[model samples]
Target chain A: MRSQSEPTQSAGKRAAPPYEQIKLFLKERLENGHWTPGALMPSEADLVAKFAVSRMTVNRALRELQLEGLVDRVQGVGTFAAQLHRVSSSLTIRDIHEEVLERGHVHHATVHLAKAESASATAAQRLGVGLNASVFHTVIVHYENGVALQCEDRYVNPECAPDYLSVDFTKITPTHYLLDVAPLWEARFAVEAGLPTAREAKLLGLKITDPVLIVSRRTVNRGVPITQARLVHPAGRYQIDGVFKP
Target chain B: MRSQSEPTQSAGKRAAPPYEQIKLFLKERLENGHWTPGALMPSEADLVAKFAVSRMTVNRALRELQLEGLVDRVQGVGTFAAQLHRVSSSLTIRDIHEEVLERGHVHHATVHLAKAESASATAAQRLGVGLNASVFHTVIVHYENGVALQCEDRYVNPECAPDYLSVDFTKITPTHYLLDVAPLWEARFAVEAGLPTAREAKLLGLKITDPVLIVSRRTVNRGVPITQARLVHPAGRYQIDGVFKP
Candidate 1:
């Protein structure tokens, strides 16, 4: 996408302040992973020349990003994009499909298991249901570029999503369906490193020795437990990385 | 949430196995934060006497707890409760000591390595310093109740925190020390899963087979890189978990 920064400097009637426009332009590239973490950003002189703005305006934009933890600047040294990979400073629980697609990549799911099962001890406690109660189960392997990215083992509260079993998970992810059926009010997440179980290793095409990042999340809606999901990703390929402003 | 009061009402002969009874008794104390993380647990002999069971039964009970990462059993030292801290939200970068103390537990640190080192390729790039530049390096093992929870391998920009190597890490955390010298501007964080290196495994007293949760953090101040830290925790023993509201 073309940066809107160049024309804004010449357009006197533009509503956005010069520094705000510069911030927007820089933020877009950073968010798109274009600059990447530790990559040097444009020098203030370069930005001033390109945007046709004073050094002060360019400095303000860089200063704001530095304050927001998106960029790091050093005296007599160039500014660099702060570490951005594997970061998840965004406070939203987004679907894997959306995350992949947002990066201009294809995201597909291979549903291996989708059925209702009697809640095991873990499922019962995580979902806050009676022991042996009916819990909707789905095991899906999400793929990016036909390579497995995540093994999503999710247990849903039947009361929250009665149609969970019937939905074609290959098209609609469990996260997407659950969001439509039960608006997530809050989330509790515990992240750890673990060896994938035998079944997970097989489905994800991973060796048992390969460590995977596991995000165990229990989501609630209106004070009621809705779903608990175990999302596992390859250690070398995926991580929760990002920076955020308070 | 099963009420176990009925079994206690009899108080004559417990239905549970001797080991199970012991487990429940210990679990109650741990959950109530009475024992606190890192606090030494009762010895096997003491447990056996209290539960009126054989040492074998108490051994079995403690072994189970150890596997679950609830307690640490040093070969020569006594068993201590594992860290159940860091339950911090996404917004804050908290000190490990503060996290432990918040749970009413004791916190301590062992400074394994603290000195100036030439920046390696990874360190130079991460800290945005020239290759072979002098960088402050430190490796510290943080404990909660005497149970090692985190192995922190940290690199600091000498320009930002000149007195990094001089401060006694056993008394003050790097996080605490850096904040005073270099006011934190912003932070970048990435959480992953991986196996620890030989040195890390040794420091944390973990086997090579054990998985570890790794949090790589880059903090900047006034647009300058302050410190980049690699924090490793035993997968089964420690995790980053919490609930947050929008």
Candidate 2:
């Protein structure tokens, strides 16, 4: 493929903004992994001279990149590359249905199964309950346009909500139900890349080695963990979000 | 290399536990980007036959994989691969010192510049304050082991905290000083990936096109935002953490 930014001056005249061109060039470099994480670039003056743009234009491109968390700038010093580390933010925890609808996409769910069950050792530890404690397990297959999208397998502590199993998961989501029952005093979550097994691959209509997005959440109310649930979404479907207090 | 698993067959002849072997294999694949996010694998029965293991063993591997947020399984259907989306979880949020210490590394910071100033239009809008509001701006360069790491540019709302310029940011972090003065009610934050410009790259000792982790936060007290800060960290050095209810 032709270079998106080859510095074709075209007689040193162009219609687009110089800063935009520089921005596009740098963006293309980043996307193509040319610069990579933790790599440094040329100085402002250097960029100006090379790109045949003013210092202000180069500053704008760099300023925006810094605001977007792409670069780090220091006064009396040169610029450097930024290390793109794992991000944990607050924008991802909204209800999936609400999120999808907010994006102007249709969303729906199919309750595959729901029931009361005994907690396993892992669940006991994570939920802070005794082994075999009465827990509510629910399995739901969410869909977008009748296509399987997510498989939500949740385990709720009955001590937090005794009537968990009695509620109809088909009408309301586990998130909404849990929030209604316990009011979400606090929560802890994690996201990571994962691979699905044959069963899961078939359900999502993906091939082996396709990436998946997994989110694990644990909720506490008054210092007591009310429930710990894991929500699974197929690749290219969902993301995570959160915020930090200064 | 030899398999990293415990033998579990008949007293003397059992092969490695399927879960351990599977986990190891998948770990290798992920590190190699073979079974990247959203990749699927064969079914339990197929894996069992392929590895010559019992269905129970394969079940154990698949079960743990789900807990780790690797796959999505649906009843009466198949499983699907999960995507390793951008850093989206709230689990990586933490104090810089804590994070560095947790990694068995050293942490340090150098205040490149710290001064009080007025909030710009974007800052005022984000903080939900009056136009041209008086604000405290502090720019810092955080480092890890003499390696320039993060460049933090912060703007504090003077309306929320009147004595914004009295403290010494050289000795303490803005986070520490802010918490001491304002009892936080809530915080909204965001994180993203991108590249940096010439000046920023110099301070962070990064190269061009290096991926950067940018964290922006706004804290509110009684429905009024007191501070809006942007923290930039080397993508390799920083991660955010959180827990979401439901």
lDDT of 2 by residue, B168-188 (tens): 665666776666566454577
Worst 10 residues of 2 chain A by lDDT: A83-92
The candidate maximizing lDDT is: 1
Candidate 2: Cα lDDT at B47: 70
What is the CA-based DockQ of model 1? 0.19
Q: How close is candidate 2 to the true structure, as a TM-score?
A: 0.39
Clashes of each: 8, 77
lDDT of 1 by residue, B1-246 (tens): 333421232367647876777777777676655675668998987776666667867886787777555678997788886653112124243567778898899889999898899999988987777899999999999999999999999999989888788999999888877756664545787888988999999999999878899988887754677789999998888877657543
Q: Could you report the DockQ of all the candidates, in the order they appear?
A: 0.19, 0.09
Residue lDDT tens for model 1, A36-56:
567799999999988888897
